[model samples]
Target: MFDMENTTVLDRPMLDELVPSRYALKIGEIDVLVISDGVLPLPTTMLAHNAEPAVREAWLNDMYLPKDAFDWALNVMVARSGGRTILIDAGLGLDPDLQLPRAGQLMKRLEAAGVNLGSVTDLVLTHMHMDHIGGLLVDGVKRQLRPDLQIHVSAAEVEFWRSPDFSRTAMPPGFPDALRATANHFMEEYGSHLRTFESSHEVAPGVVVRRTGGHTPGHSVVRLASGGEGLTFAGDAVFAVGFEQPNWHNGFEHDPEEAARVRIDLLRELAESGEMLVATHLPFPSVCRVAAEGEVFRWVPVFWDY
Candidate 1:
């Protein structure tokens, strides 16, 4: 059994010291590390799309969070099993043109944690969001970071982004073009190395990918099982205030209603089973568990060894 007593919680001051930028944990024999890619500022209004201003403010107030914007963390999970290094999601790469100024720190932080980029054998993408796949390339040209990297993504996700109609979708002003460009870039750069899978499949020894589409056409989650312990990498499936209000759809989701439905069901299952969840856009080191509270749910962040 995994020991919960050794877990430590770092305050903002200690976190700022960069000592807690990465968190280490183990699921059975698989060694896992949660690396920070820095935080990005996102308007609270954009996140609580379906909620009224008053309601959203109340929720933020309850959580002691800012009313206008949220400092969302970009956490990338790395797992080592059976002598293979697997990266769950690539963080925002070192792209100067990207709007978010605080992101794209994955490589540096990983190095600080003693991880080598060239050692990554598998890159698993939960979805194709810019923040998630940005690190797949360095400045949109080099694929030389990982010599043996094999890209894995959902088949549906590939089709959605590659479709000619993708550029004509009703997306935020400049997003459609950006999405098309990123998709085309990946196809051109990693076409031969890309591997698409169906509904649920084991990507690594103890890591399994399950399609939970809603946030995006190919949105999915990674479930790691070993030594009688399990943790789920909930890729944009839930964000701040999302655990408390699973039905509140975010503006970023391609299908808001479906996203809500998927979030509700997934949160319910995780809460009941007490599985650890590593959220991509929650607080730094975004490892938490869910607890069913009446009709909603609550976030219970894990404490790691300091």
Candidate 2:
């Protein structure tokens, strides 16, 4: 039985003053913070499954979020522990090619949080999507954030993004090739730091990689455990829990069925285990818990009064 109601954790403010959307969670001696790079607006039709027009329209209308547009919050997580700074996903770096407004605010927020990119020793890439890996390189040539940090990505993910299959498909315009090139650049610049993890292996002492393929072929999630606290970094597995009702597929999922399955399983696991989760596309801060009532699942924002 999952608690479908909000917990006492939400009583506190979760975000920092510099970036109102970003939030920080403390686990033992580690500091895990989620920073907002920006947001985007997409069509609701692109997100809905082939369902009744009236029903979907009604749902969107009731929520007040325009059916013609869906707002997606972009976030990147930074982990600091044992004097080593690690960044989970890079946000959309400044790019004339990308239309998203939240592009390239990592360094700004980091500085606001009193963090220097040069101190980062490792980078854990959940997947190589443009929004997630955009900040990996700066101005398309320099490694701006972390010049000396090791960048770890799953081998399967690396292969999939680099494959010609991506470029050959009818992907959203200007998405495939540019993203592929970034992946190649990362591999080249940080080959020594570029390591791969199997399906379920520990990347750091308290951070482990869990496969949750769907958004991308080799997409996965990150689980952080330290002391008595636990949290999962659900990268695009379940965007806004609103449209992704129950165990439904996200509209942009490459393989909708796979995305639905992975999301359902993840919700079930989170509900049963009572662990915390932070999704990239979820609202800023994006931290919540899954609650199961009968067959319907809901996201209960963690009451983190920071």
lDDT of 1 at 210: 88
Stretches > 4 Å off in candidate 1: 1-19, 140-143, 164-173
Cα lDDT tens digits for candidate 2, 120-226: 78777878877777675666334454556677777778777556354212344555667677767766765676778768666667877776777777788888888
lDDT score, candidate 1, position 216: 85
Highest TM-score: which candidate?
1
lDDT of 1 by residue, 5-117 (tens): 43333343332344467778888888888888888776787676778899999988988989998788899999988777888988877667666767887766665565667
Q: Model 1 lDDT vs. the true structure?
A: 0.79
Model 1, TM vs. native? 0.89
